[model samples]
Target: AGSSGSRGPSPLTIGMADTIPLAVAFHEIIHSYFRGTEESKCQVKMSGDMMLSFPTGIVGVLANNPNPAKLCFRLKNIHRLDNVLPNKQLISINTMMSTRDTTVVDFNMPALTALLRRQSEKNPTAQYFNVDILKYQIRPKAGAASCPFQLVAYWKCEQDHTDLKVDYKYNLHAMSPPSPLLNVSVCVPMNGEVKNVIAMPKNIWNGENEQALWRFTELSQHSDDRGVGSLRARFELDKGPSSKGTISAQFNCEGATLSGIEFELVGSGYRLSLVKRRFVSGKYICDSEVH
Candidate 1:
């Protein structure tokens, strides 16, 4: 839908939108069928790396894209408390985390195992799951904004108007990689407010032709019934002729000093690791092999 301030991109290709959803649908269905079993047929291809043969026993073309490239458009959690029956029915909250709720929705559940003895089931032709993201901060020690994860989900039941309990995890990666050498401190606030005060990564790349600046490539978080549970941070080189240097992040919270750090691709990744460990008293350590 177009709006007053900006026009949205054209609708997504039907095939592309259905790709990840299809995978997620199967995952959920397997979980339902297996119930208490630790091993389920769905586990056959748990990792996206393996090719899976469906009911037809035919394997579809598996894409070679990086695992990180898969779009996690929606994240949901099934809480035991809200079910219709005691220890019987399962209640799941469907969350859509996009700017606009997707109008078209469908669901399918097939009896993947003989133990269930159920045939394929599909939801109605259309449904909607709206998602809202709230930021919460993690205090240095304890504070009103103290939390580990960055994202939150809210849901209300139409029948009772009672607040529905929901949980979700956001796949958020820090734009910067966690440093092995430096101590990194992260503070989560209420409503996705983050006071990042971790020492910057020490640049290791010094080649004349390589880029050597530090920058976060990704940042995200997740929330659920128990509060924040997901955390991630990733950093990459910025454009510039290769050069090496030290960076620092510092912040204070509830009388505690919090810091998480990284040591970058300098000519001396080894030495940088040692210096970083000493820098944050072994706070957020980076991989020694990251040269």
Candidate 2:
């Protein structure tokens, strides 16, 4: 019995040998990844906002290249690109062509807007390009979710419509899975002296910047969309509100990026180690009609 068993130690020994190699291999892989360097990192981020002009099918989009390094981005479901501007330095027209229902644009390093380029002096920190990916759409499609929320806002102003009784109401719908913005704050520029202030769901005031600031604290810490938030206020304006005065807001979500654009590294010998994307609100004007 002992001589027969000596041929091989046991089945347990064989299993241990096989398991050891796999565990060691995984450990080394993780160790090398966490020990990465700057050059080893290859990532892309996209930041932009969506402008919704009510009573119209069009939606305005403003996008800026995320990385400082010269990179190419393939934007899916976008209406158009900034090709007619005649700036070859910021956008590489030759390579950014795609036949599919997608727009590809190569953003050059240190990309500068036309307004910035015209000036003799330029700010290095403010280097960016303005590309209206979706200036207009025939009808807002289902996947057009660059903006996180589908905001339904209403304005009820008397005939005076200025320096008198004014009212504003808004309802923010998450639109997609990136629901419940962690920190939601809507800023409405008073454009005059704001008084007789009143707000719904608490937390609202007239800031020193001459704007009515409404912060949705409960919604900010929400697990899901809380349905709606409303506010009512009366202001004694020294001057009528500016025509350009519109509602601007901040919707920060830890779940997903607001832009709805995804990135993937498509080359060999390089793994997409990490990706970070952020979409901050620029102009969140809500109106009943596109004026």
Candidate 3:
């Protein structure tokens, strides 16, 4: 056995499955142990050897906003294999939007691969292997309003000469419980300056680069204790009418995956260990209409 050189708490432990001891052992060791002469001995050895040791788990979150419809997906590999890399691994993503209207626009896998390649190239001692998988993207003709859980924005502006009063209304609805933190960023036009901002249920607000950032924590399915979880924000702009600026948002919810991805072990002879993956939304944006 080799040390994985991991620093934190060990995620692996020994337990009993039925009457058998579920212990971690290398593939070669299991194969050698099962090599026997008698039929009964071979059967016993094979049964014991069937237990494979591998680490598998994933944690992720997905976020979206509806000003300039966009999506950002991020994932992490939580498997705890010390020195061994799987022979084959594949990650597949499927969007739940209506196949007729929505399409994937940008996927970051190519950029990620290029980054990894650059790092490996810079460090000659570092070994790298590309996973075999097909990446995809889609474009929605009507934006992300059709998503199961989405944020929709509408703007109203009244202009009196050079002065303007703008009211922003935002609605966030979810069919299922999503991540607890909802991040909203609204871009302010160059000709306009934000005068005041207010949100129901009280949230944190920060301004940078002519954009306002609103953060809502501990969000539930309803906005209040008595109603379904939703959010609304109104912003007042001065100097000019509100322009249709980009609105982007992000959040992480458990038990929901944007891309229905699955993992399987290939050329490993058997299901030697567990392999898990998770997908979450990152920086999802949608277009808004200002009237």
How large an RMSD does model 1 have? Answer: 25.5
How does candidate 3 fare on TM-score?
A: 0.40
What RMSD does model 2 have?
20.3
lDDT over C-alpha atoms for residue 134 of model 3: 32
Ranking by lDDT: 2, 3, 1
Candidates, ranked, TM-score = 2, 3, 1
Candidate 3 least-lDDT 10 residues: 56-65
Over 92-203, each residue of candidate 1 has an lDDT whose tens digit, in order, gives 2223422122211111112122111221123122121111111111113221111112222222212212121112222122111221112223221111111221222333
Worst 10 residues of 2 by lDDT: 22-31
Candidate 2 residue-wise lDDT, 115-195, digit = tens: 334331343332222233222121222321233443433444432233211222222332223444546676666654554
The top-ranked prediction according to lDDT is: 2
lDDT digits (tens) for residues 1-291 of candidate 3: 111332222223222221111112211110111111121221101000111221211000011111211212222221211222222222223345213222222224344334344544575443222222233221111233213334444445544112212222222332112323233333333235666667554444454555545554534445454223434556556665656554555444333322322222322112212222212344344344422
Off by over 4 Å in 2: 1-146, 156-179, 191-195, 217-225, 234-245, 254-259, 287-291
**TM-score of every candidate:** 0.15, 0.41, 0.40
Cand. 1 TM to true fold: 0.15
* lDDT against true structure, model 3: 0.31
